[model samples]
Structures are given as structure tokens and as C-alpha cells.
Target: MFFSQLINLKEDDSSMQFIIITHDAEIFDDSSVENIYKFESAPDGTIVSRL
Candidate 1:
């Protein structure tokens, strides 16, 4: 509910920008969000990639 509210607020306010860190793929189920950065574990360290 709260997550949906945040999206609604962003839509209502054009200047609003949000950076959400979530493991839920549902966040990407909508087109309201643009740009995605994924992080995963690696043997040496962490790997960051743009998805």
C-alpha cells in the first residue's frame, strides 16, 4: 500500500524523484519506473550492473 502511495505521489508531483532498493520484481511490473540497477554477489566481491 505504501509503495503504491509513493508512486502515486511521484506521479502527482512532477519534480519528485525516487530511488528504491527492493528485491521484489513487482516494482518493475509497471512502466512508471525508469532505469534499473541490479546488484549481485560475486566470489571476489559485489557486482553492480544496469538492467
Candidate 2:
């Protein structure tokens, strides 16, 4: 599985990190995801909200 592969890669290098952007709400269901954020653009400027 993709998550399992990611786990292996992280174990091989403890300092590794990743920036994965996806529309799938399933990603948020994973416990390993330490942080979550939403990004959007508006007439004023770009806005980011931490979920």
C-alpha cells in the first residue's frame, strides 16, 4: 500500500518529510499526518487555513 511504502521510506531516513496535496478526505483520516491546511485564492490575495 502507498501508506506502507511511505512508512518504510520514513524509517530508512528519520529526517524525511513530505508535502502531499490531494482532494481525497481520506488523507486526513491517517494518524501520521501531523498537520493539515487548506489553501485558496481570493480577489484580495491567497488565503490559508489550518485545519
Clashing pairs in 1: none
Error of 1 at 34 (Å): 1.9
* Count of steric clashes across candidates, in order: 0, 0
**Which lDDT values do the candidates have, in the order given?**
0.75, 0.74
Worst 10 residues of 1 by lDDT: 9-18
TM per candidate:
0.53, 0.65
In Å, residue 7's CA in model 1 sits off its true spot by 7.9
4-48 in candidate 1: lDDT tens per residue?
676676635566566778898676876666778888999999999
RMSD, each candidate, Å? Answer: 3.5, 2.3
